[model samples]
Target chain A: MLSIKNLHASVEGKEILKGINLEIKAGEVHAIMGPNGSGKSTLSQVLAGNDAFEVTSGSVTMNGENLLEKETEERARDGVFLAFQYPVEIPGVSNLQFMRTSVNAMRHHRGESEMNAAEFMKLAREVSKQVDLDPAFLKRGVNEGFSGGEKKRNEIMQALMLQPKLAILDETDSGLDIDALKVVSDGVNALRAEDRAILMVTHYQRLLDHIVPDFVHVLADGKIVKSGGRELALELEDRGYAWLGIKDDETAANSAN
Target chain B: MTTANKEVNELIKREYEHGFVTDIEVDTFEPGLSEDVITRLSEIKKEPQFMLEWRLKAYRRWLEMEEPDWAHLGYDRIDYNSVSYYSAPKRKEDMPQSLDEVDPELLKTYEKLGIPLHEHAKLAGVAVDAVFDSVSVATTFKEPLAKAGVIFCSISEAVRDYPELVQKYLGTVVPHTDNFFAGLNAAVFSDGTFVYVPKGVRCPMELSTYFRINAANTGQFERTLIIADEGSYVSYLEGCTAPMRDENQLHAAVVELVALDNAEIKYSTVQNWYPGDENGKGGIYNFVTKRAACIGKNSKVSWTQVETGSAITWKYPSCILRGEGSVGEFYSVALTHNHQQADTGTKMIHLGKNTTSTIISKGISAGKSSNVYRGLVKFGPRAEGARNFTECDSLLIGDQCGAHTFPYIESLNKSAIVEHEATTSKVSDEQMFLCRQRGIDMERAVSMIVNGFCKDVFKELPMEFAVEAGKLLEVSLEGSVG
Candidate 1:
């Protein structure tokens, strides 16, 4: 359902994603693991249509529609979701308000009537429970003064509420405690379905234990250098990236190039 | 470069919707101001002898006073001599005794401005005094208001009928010699609304007045007076719009409100005068003076204004808390875009013991516009244990715009407590991108954020007016993305 061909991306005159190719089918979950500066976050941003990353060469398509041609919001309307590693704080804009606007925008794009206030409130409450967030927090400014763990859970809640076709979780487990990690993973596991796909990008192998992936690819520099099964994450965790012939950031970035 | 951004660009190019000139013959004075002109205006209104004397005295003071330049504004020098002092629709030999006989064209102009004269639309039940150009055309819901012992009519009519009320409170709150614009307004003020709620009475409904400027080269000087007697309460609303023109039209208005013993008055205004073109060609110079006096113990007065238009605006709605335990509050949201400039705030004077005041101001500047918040709070010697809290926030949408704040506080009582807080913020790219990525478009995102920024002030507005204010801000900030 998703395809990326020779995705070469750059930012501010520096190439980040160099000659990367990947294809994922429906009902599949893929994990891309790498050390620092392995272009893991760059891959997620380029897929989500961050304009700062210039896609010099290659194309991305979702269900035969060129995802690269759509604007960021249009991409979102087309069912692409990105869980930011650092959630933005929009003071004065309540989280509930933002969620309602987003939900209505998607509904409009799908030729559906707006969700009524009561119906929206019900859906919001149900989603908040799934992420273990108190509904009262929804009335506060979006992520304003939120804890590190709460921000990650809020991002997951947004993904769950939108119910996108392809979800990209970028460093969702970085700043989470053990309890928050379990709660967030449970929400993600609940969202897994036959017609949806999940792309998990992480540096540590810890998250793979919670939401196991069908495919694991090791990204070095800007290319996917290794593709394997769940066992690959366990092996990397035991021996580290050096065991896979990957040195520290200095050598890994050059050798992969 | 998204569809939302493109739509915002188109909205920015939209022409002024309320700029159409009404086709009606008018009785307009020649372009100039003199003692003779003031005398003629008083005679046309058929004012009492004292009214004429007041106008003449104000005109003399105006001549001696130079235009003040203390405000944070920049514009071409106003050619006062080139502006017509009065322009009113020529009344028929027999004026309309009811709404039906009113000129259809004049009624249509009000209709086009989303104001209904039939009294059955959404704004029904609220008494409205429609002032066109320099004279009031019609007053609606007068009978209902009158049956409730409420005196609601045009200032001219009030002078003719309830002379005592008008004479007692005309310039009491904002005296004729208050400032440059106030003096000019007092000198040649043509027409406005007069509202009086009798003692021990709460007004049955909201009282509103709509001011429209259609005549070219004419200056609109309106005088609005409202009096809430002892133990009474009233909410008064004022709104204005002007037709588009190539030359800046002058709108100098004075509003005075009085709240007697244990009385409460709430005054709200939504001012949307023309803000000229994108490059700032022609608009309205809106210099208005509004003041309320708490004259009796425990009397309360609040001023709420949403200012979103005008090429240059200089206004300060103030309250004088003279009575013991009286309360004063000011809530404002001022937005300036596309070369528009606004310098507006409030003044609160605590002259009695235990008096309190609160101020919340929100200023949004977009495009190349400039917005400033200038406020003052004073505590007199007898204002023992008085308190004041002031909060001001400024939001900038683009790099070319500017925001400034000037707050002055003076306290003579050692027991008085005053607090002030101010903040400045920009619409960052991260916030914009986050909203866009969530499927909400940029234009909606900008407006939503701005509305959130102004939520405090908007809540103070009446329901209908709050909705209108939200829409006005959205239109004003279109294409202001940086």
Candidate 2:
């Protein structure tokens, strides 16, 4: 469903994602574990088409369609979702209104009829329950004055509503409490399907316990040093990436191979 | 229109929108300042002698005064003599008694401007006073307003019939010498709506004035004076729009409000004067002076405005809290798109003890436009226990546009509490992505986000105006984001 070939990326003239190569099929959960500044967030931003980051080399494709050429919104309509590490606070925009607009926009882009107010409210109600979000909060401004946990949960709820083909959760569990993490994971787990893929980016191995990954790739200094099963997260958790002794360039070569 | 046609038409249209007129039919006089024009305008209105003398005094004071340049705006020197002192729609010797008697073409023009005066005449609820150029075309609900002892009519008629009321309140809140435009409006304003809510009476319906500019190369100078007597309440709405022209038309208007002890006045404006075209050609230069005074104890006055037009808009509808425990509020949403420029905000002067004021301003700039929020909150020495809260936010749609907030806070009383908050930001791609990821397309996302950014001020508007404002923002920022 997704392919990245020698994905070299930089932000503000500094190289971050150094020749990253990855392949994922549908219905699979992939976890990318990296140390601080290992380009974990940068990779997510680059994939989501953040203008700040420049892709210096390589190509990315989703379902055989070139992704880099598409605008951020176009990429999103084509079924790509990125859960931000820090959710933006839009003061005057209500969460529910934002959700409805997004859902209808995506539907419109797919050449489908737009949803009426009643239909949108119905979907919002259902999704709110799935993410354990209170309906009242939906009427509040988008992420304005929201707690960290609420922001993460709202992102999950949005993802659940959009039902994207590829869901990239970047540090979704970073600031969430145990309860919020559980709710978010449950929402993500419910979204798992045969034709969908999940890319979980995290520093801690704890999230892996909730949403177990089929493939765990350890990223260090902008490259993936090792790739293994769920046990790899446990190994990295027990003994940090120092034991690997693999620099970022070596990891890129290994992943390319 | 197709994009190509729009482009071609826009070029031809641009020249006319901003071109200077040379041979337009205009009634003019000599360049120097004088009381003669004031007397002539009053005589044309057939106003009483006292009103004529009032104008004479104001005109004399205006000559001694200097044009105000303190406002955060810039413009070339105005050729005062070149401007006509009065330019009314040619009316029959006899006044029109009904809608059918009025000029059908003029009525059609009003209809095209979205003000259905004929229907309003038939409707029982809404009352409208259609002011064209420099004269009142027709006033609806005259009898109904008269039944309540509420004198709602043209300022000219008020000078003739309700002389005492007009004399008691005119220029009391905002003196003629207050500013250059105010003095000019006081001197040469041909005619405008005059509303008087009697003491202890609640106005039965919303009072509205629709101002239109039709004659070529003529400035529209209208004066609006609304007085809500003690224990009275009234809501007055004003809307303005002009025909497409190439040369920059001048529209300098003055609106004054007086809220007596325990009285409340709410004034709202939706100004859509012809904004110059995309390349900043031909549109109205709207320089207006609107101010209100809370004179009696516990009196309240509020100003709400939605400015979405004009080539250069310079207006600051303000309030003066003179009575103890009086309240003043200003809520504004100014949008400048496609080469428009606006410098507007409000001022609240707290002079009485325990007075309070609140100001919320939201400015959106797109397409090389510039929007500014310049406000002042002042607390006098006797204004003990005064409090004020102000919030100004700007949303920049494109990098080429600019938004600025200049708030002046002065407190002479040590017990006063004043707080102000302002922020400027561009719509971020990341934020748009988050919305799109939720299924919102980029345009919808932009609209939703921008609306949210202005939700704080929108909530302050009346229900109907709030909805209209939301939709207006959407239309104003169309094609702003990709």
Candidate 3:
């Protein structure tokens, strides 16, 4: 469903993603684990068309369509969803309103009719229940004064609403607790569809223990140094980057020893 | 990103939609201001002699008064002599006796302004009094209004037919000697709406006035007086959509509202005057004074205004809570794009025991515009247990614009409590990215954020006007996204 060839991206003229390549077909889930500054988040941002990172020498395609040529919103409408590491706070804009507008925009792009407020509300309420988010929070400002777990659930709620073809989760599990992790995992497992793909970028195997990936790729220094199945995550958690000849902190290696 | 910002800014430079001149012959006073000019204007309207004397008194007082320079505004001193004080669409006979007798051209102009005068068909529950350059053309549903013991007519008609009521209420809230703009408006004011709801009577329909300044080189000085008697209720709307083109920039107007015992008055204004060209060459200078007096115990008055146009706007819609346990509320959303400057807020004066007031103001500045909120909350010596709550928020769209807040609080009563909260925020790029990434366009995203910022004030507007205000904000925010 998604393809990246020699993805070289940078921020502020500093190279972040250096000549990286990845491919995932429909109904597949891929996990990219990396140390700090290893371009895990940058990959998600660049694929979602965030302009802050310039794609200097890369070509990305979604369903055989050139994705790099589209704007951020256009890419979103084309079914590329990026769950931001830190979801932004838009004060005064109700979550329901923001979601409704997004849903309508995507529906319009797909040549489908726009859903009325009542119909959309019904769907949103059901989805919020699935995510364990209070329906009352839907009426509040988008991520305004929301707790870390609530913001994560809100981003997951949006992913569920959009039903994107390729969902990119950028450290969505960073601030979630055990209970929140379970709820978030349940929501993601529900999105395991026959025609959709998931790319979760995380720093630990804790998230993989719930929503286990079909394939795991350890990204070090912007390139995939190792690729394997779900057990690769456990190995990384056990041995850390030092086992792969990459130096991070001594804590993970010392603990492994 | 640069290209996107360019497109956004281009949309922000939207042409003034109602800048086309209405081609109609008008009976106009030569460009000047004097006692002779006031007399001639009064005589033209067939005003009572006492009314003329009142205007003369105001004129003399205006001569002694120097224009106040305290407001945070920048504009060249107005050339009063260069502006024609009066310009009415010429009629072959006396002012139209009914809607049928009104000129078709004038009606067309009002229709273009979205206030149909030929019939009360479009606006089913709202009765509108359409005011052209310097006089009222037609007031719809006058008979129905009169049936309810509610007198809704042009101020000129009220002066002639209901002189006692007009004499009693005019300038009672905002006295002619109150300030520089009020004095000038009292002396040279040509025409405005007048409402008098009798005791125990609730106005049947929404009363409204649409003020349009069509003629070139003529200043539209409007005087509006509303009096709600004991146990009465009324909601009045003014200045819908665009105020059309005004070659003559000065628009000094006064509006006074009075609510008696147990009476309630709600006033809403959607002011879309011309803000001039992109270069800020020619636009209307809107200097208006609007105040309401809660004169009797338990009276309530609320002012909700959405001001989006004007080159330089100096307005302060205030309330004097003189009645015991009286209440006053003000909700305003003032947006200035391009070179527009608006320094508008409200004054809440607590004089009665247990009186309370709430003020919420939202200011949005874009394209190098300057928007300021200057509000005053005062409590008198006898105002025991009186309280005031105020919130002023400013949103800047682009880097070029600016927003400011000037809040003054004075309390003589030790028992009084006043709370003030102010915030200054920008239409940040992160906010924009969040919205755009959700598949909304730039315009829709900007408007959404801005509308959320102004949700508090917009809720106070009438239902239909609330919708219009949202669209107006969307249209006004073009090019501010950068």
Error of 3 at A149 (Å): 1.5
lDDT of 2 by residue, B1-482 (tens): 22112222222222222122222233443333456666777777888888877788778787788877765555677777766666665556535777777777777666665567785444346688988778888888888889998888988778888899889888887788888788878877888999999899999988889888777677788999999999999988887877778777889999999999999998888877888777787789999988999989999998988888788999988889999999999998898877888999999999999999999998988777889999999999999999999999898775667898889888899999998888887677557656654656556777787787777677766666678768766765556654
Clashing pairs in 1: none
Model 3 stretches with alpha carbons more than 4 Å out: A250-257, B1-11, B120-122, B240-248
In model 2, the runs with Cα more than 4 Å from the true position are A247-257, B1-40, B120-124, B337-340, B366-370, B397-404, B439-442
Candidate 2, residue B124: CA error in Å? 7.7
Worst 10 residues of 2 chain A by lDDT: A248-257
| Best by the TM-score measure | 3
Which model scores highest in lDDT?
A: 1
lDDT string for model 2 (A111-134, tens) is 999899899899899999888888
- The predictions' CA RMSDs to the true structure, in order, are 3.2, 5.3, 2.1
The lDDT ranking, best first, is: 1, 3, 2
- Just chain B of model 1: what TM-score? 0.96
lDDT by residue (B24-69, candidate 3, tens digit) is 8889889998999999999998999999999999999998999988
Q: How well is candidate 2 docked (DockQ)?
A: 0.37
CAPRI-style grade of the A/B interface in model 1:
medium
Say what the RMSD of model 2 is.
5.3
